[model samples]
Target: MNYQALFEQIKKKKSFLCVGLDSDMKKIPTHLLSSTDPVFEFNKAIVDATADYTVAYKPNVAFYECRGAVGWRSLEKTVIYIKDNYPDIFLIADAKRGDIGNTSKMYASAFLENMPFDSITVAPYMGEDSVTPFLEYDNKWVILLALTSNKGAFDFQFFEENNKKMFEKVLEKSQEWGTKENMMYVVGATKAEMLSDIRKIAPDHFLLVPGVGAQGGSLKEVAKYGMNQSCGLLVNSSRGIIFADTSDQFAIIAQIKAKELQKEMENLLIEYSIL
Candidate 1:
């Protein structure tokens, strides 16, 4: 989807929520094991339940890849199912892929061309060559890892040189290769305080924010600092929404959780004067 199309969805739904489909097989309810493809079945249910409240869905590729070829098939089926049914929903391959130019080109084609993902999370450490390949596809996005939510982020992301942090350099240098339309930065909700600084650098580009809910990232703080004129945020929640329950009513419970976040997002949009 294009930038305006995405903003339209956010306004239409009164939300910018992205549901993370971290569909780990072991975490799914045991009843689904009887199904032919438990992971896909679980994902189908979760997608159907949360579609009304979400503008995007991110499938963490590792969850599927770890299961081998069978897992890969399940991932493909899940992506196809979302696109076929919920065509407007932005689909993200949370693969965090970035390699040498040739390898990155293959990776980009594998996800952006072979599969119908709207975006893919990419590591920026390899610099322009590794990330530029993904930007080759029209209307597809490359979500570069910037200020992450994990504790380990402190090790390198904050390292300074001439008073500029590593992540700051990543954000600055990356802009030369991609624009707000085709590129976004991953800023974890846990680091909400740093958002104002991030906004100064990327005031208009969208931010794919994870680490809400289950990770204890405050929604209020995220909006207070990270929100922009276009509601440039896609706050994601995974375990706290999808895995809220493990029984037959999992989907129903998931819907409730999603709706709760959507309602809060609507209020945020209004408060920020972006609605």
Candidate 2:
């Protein structure tokens, strides 16, 4: 989906919540083990339950990739199910991939073509050539990593280059490769204070914000600094939503968790006058 369509969805639903499907086999409810495609089953239930309140669904690639071909198949089924049923739901493949030009193109095809995903997480350490290959797709997006929430992010993102933080430099430089239309950024919600710094550089770009739930990032702080006139934020919640319970009520509990966030987001959108 293009940025405009996504924004419209946010306005229509009064939500910019991206529900993370980090479904792990071991962590799923035991009842799902009886299903032929347990992983897909789990994701489908979560999607069905939360679709009304969410604008996006992100499947952390590692969960499916680790389970081998069966896991991969499960991932494909989940993607196809969402596309077929929830066609407007933005699907993100949380595969943080980046490499040389040729390799990056291959990775891009694997996610954006072979499998259908609206966007994928990308590491920017390899620079423009590694990142832009993913941007070649018309409506697909490359969510470049920036000011992440992890503690270790300080080790390198803070490095100075021409008196600018490394992530700031990444934000300034990558803007040349793709506009807000086909490119976005990963700014951890835990780093909300620095969002003013982030907005100064790329005020119009959408930010795919992780770390909102289990990672303890504050939604209020994120919207306070990160929101643009367009409500440019996709605040994601994973385990805290999907794994809210491990029983027959899993999907129901997940729905409640997502609704809580969506209600908060609705108020944020109103406060910013973007509703």
User: Which candidate ranks first by lDDT, i.e. highest?
Assistant: 1
Local accuracy of candidate 1 as per-residue lDDT tens digits, 1-275: 98999999999999999999999999999999999999999999999999999999999999999999999999999999999999999999999999999999999998999999999999988999999999999999999999999999999999999999999999999999999999999999998999999999999999999999988799999999999998999999999998999999999999999999999999999999988
Q: lDDT per residue, candidate 2, 126-171, as tens digits?
A: 9989998999998999999988889999999999977899999999
The deviation in Å at residue 109 for candidate 1 is 0.7
For every candidate, C-alpha RMSD to the true structure in Å = 0.6, 0.8
Off by over 4 Å in 2: none
The runs of at least 3 residues in candidate 1 whose Cα sits more than 4 Å from the true structure, single-residue gaps closed, are: none
TM-score, candidate 2, is: 0.98
TM-score between model 1 and native: 0.99
